[model samples]
Target: MERYMSLLSPGDQPPALLGHEDIQAKLRKWITRRASGSEVSNSALIISLWGTEGAGKKTQLAHLGHYFNEPMLFVDMTKVPEEEREGPDALDNVFREAAIQQALPVLCGFLLQEDSEAMRNRKRELLDRLKTMSGIVFVLSEQPCQPIDLRSRIDLELEIPPLEGEKRSDAWRTLAAAYEVDESVDWGILASRFVFSPGQMSNAMRTARTLSEWRQEEGKSGPIRWSDMVEACYKQLNHHLDAKAKRLTPKKRWEDLVLPEAQTKKLRHACNHIQYKHTVYGLWGFDKKLSYGTGVSLLFSGPPGTGKTMAAEVVAKELDMEIYKIDLSQIISKYIGETEKNLREIFDEAEKSCAILFFDEADALFGKRSEVKDSHDKNANTEVAFLLQKIEEYGEYRLWRRTICKT
Candidate 1:
């Protein structure tokens, strides 16, 4: 029980919080108000920080502790036993620890798994306990609390947005400087190519350092190079996408893609959409105008053995990104809602890896909707709708190949 909790004293120096100046400012202002004894609520001030994993929620919590200028009790709720989790016993222990140490309680890992009556009751109880508490409390989650019961109780809910573009480049440079990485290593190129979270960037740098050390052990002595960092970043992304899609090494180049000049020009333009998206979208203010359909989605429709698959590889190689051939058999499911679940997983993994999704035989999934005569037909249409939504929502490149049979 004690192992699940740790005290983060004010003297303990955590890593610097990066790329969330707005969030940091809000947190500091909130803490300053509290410190000045300007109380708005009699109950505990619960600040909920929610975002994608590795988006630095814990880092924000640590920074929050620093702003509070007091000892903070860090509770990892995931480590608590399931039977005791959300129970009075666990709550009692947590409050007891915080009270004994005179520390602010920072609880993380509050994932709402289900919406059953029992779960609702447990959440209500938790809310009641939190509202009665008399100090500042922090809740960190990968997602915002969906339940109105819990959401209404939260005093402040700030989303820690993922680092992108310049922010990402800055994070790369900052971490490199902290880790004493080779200054010659081109972080800007790496940042542009990889849509990595700050946490991922840190992991990649550590892995790159390890690779450099391994080379030294084999009698090659040098600092971490660009190639080593690239390899390390790919290593961090490799495991998540393998289960859903088959990773393809893009061996095809533009010269190998034998198509008409007009068709070839269109393909190049499609590649440019991805290549210079930051310029067009970010720099030119197009991102503010469009809400959806920002991702580069290409539908390659042609007869069999006519280079649809080869074209996808060529585009991937042109962009210097890994391509994953999505396995239709693995994604499409017989059970209702299961297909959407699988698609969400695939898209999420693709986003993390920054890989091009190549869907071969894509018509099998994206075909015209049939008449709504049966339950199966409705489910099929639902799946298609969900797939289209995911494709539109995807921020990177997605290539789909449809085979047309010619009589």
Candidate 2:
């Protein structure tokens, strides 16, 4: 509870403790308790710093490591062998080592905690070794994992929350001080302009420092301009967002699309329905329940260079929504029912952003529904049915599902 100044030594750059006072306190308590050689149990403290990349996890980690006065060994789970990350084989090895060989002392106990008796014996060798090790272990993962398995052996699970309001200002002050900038600038206004992670903040400050020094060489006495800060923040946040589908705006007109008269007329009708719905559809008259399927579902049946794909892009451009082209190979998996899981990801992403779902050369998947003569046929039909159902359900809002025809 006391005001704790960081005891970080030279060469240890601790992250500026922004508005995370409560979080810092909790982490400090955990570190102190752990360092005293207390019986913390087999349960490991798993603190997950989750956010958009530029949201500052690395800087926070550095700061946290300094506060604890302990070296943080990062294990990037993403870099782990993908073959091992998937399937029963890798898990089998883990269990086997735990139950038979008494290896992987740190993770073996956690591995065998599962309820399955069959797995217990499979892992008994490894569990014996894990029962001896003490202290905390840290793993950094970009992708989500099966938490139940980890939770059984882990104790604490914390998600780093976003900074807001006063906390944002406090973060800026710390960042500015670390970078050595003129304190006269109002950072509260700047912080409100863009959201950045601690790592991003540090990088921006570092860049600003260099740029400011460069300006000083030219006899400029003022701190970094608001414009330069804006640019830095924009670059940092843009990288975090990644290369997302473009959000078409009003200014991006749809005049470039070359479609047949019927398709063009239908598209215009769909656009009108999307834009000015009440005047034409007679809002209350038509069943709103049916609106779920009201989303534009058009099959652009044509050869590759015939402008089918262009037409879909034009539609997205007109609607001011992002256009997402689903990868069919990824969608259609060889594993039974695995194809549906991939479909769920595509549909879920489209739903969240309300982006135009572009299924280029989609006849390969949505072929004429055939009788289920075999398991493959049955699975194919099921996939189609699932797709149809999802489109009918979540397509309540303005959505465009464009499928290009291949022959």
Best by TM-score: 1
How many angstroms is residue 295 displaced in model 2 relative to the true structure, after the best TM-score fit? 27
Which segments of candidate 2 are over 4 A away from where they belong? 1-13, 31-39, 42-49, 52-69, 78-133, 142-150, 179-184, 214-221, 239-407
lDDT per residue (tens digit) for residues 131-180 in model 1: 78887888878877767666787778888888866677788888887564
lDDT of 2: 0.53
Give the per-residue lDDT digits (tens) of candidate 2, residues 1-407: 00211222324776555666677678667766765656555643444444444554555556666665554433333343446434434434333332343221122112322446655543343223323334454333332224345344434445566675456657877777655565445575455334455556767777776777787888986777654565465445332111323333323345776667888898777665655433233324343344545455666665557766666666666554455665455468778888787777666655544346666546657777899899988988998898778777654233333445456
Which portions of model 1 show Cα errors greater than 4 Å?
38-42, 81-90, 111-114, 179-195, 212-231, 237-244, 254-266, 299-307, 326-353, 362-391, 402-407
Clashing pairs in 1: none
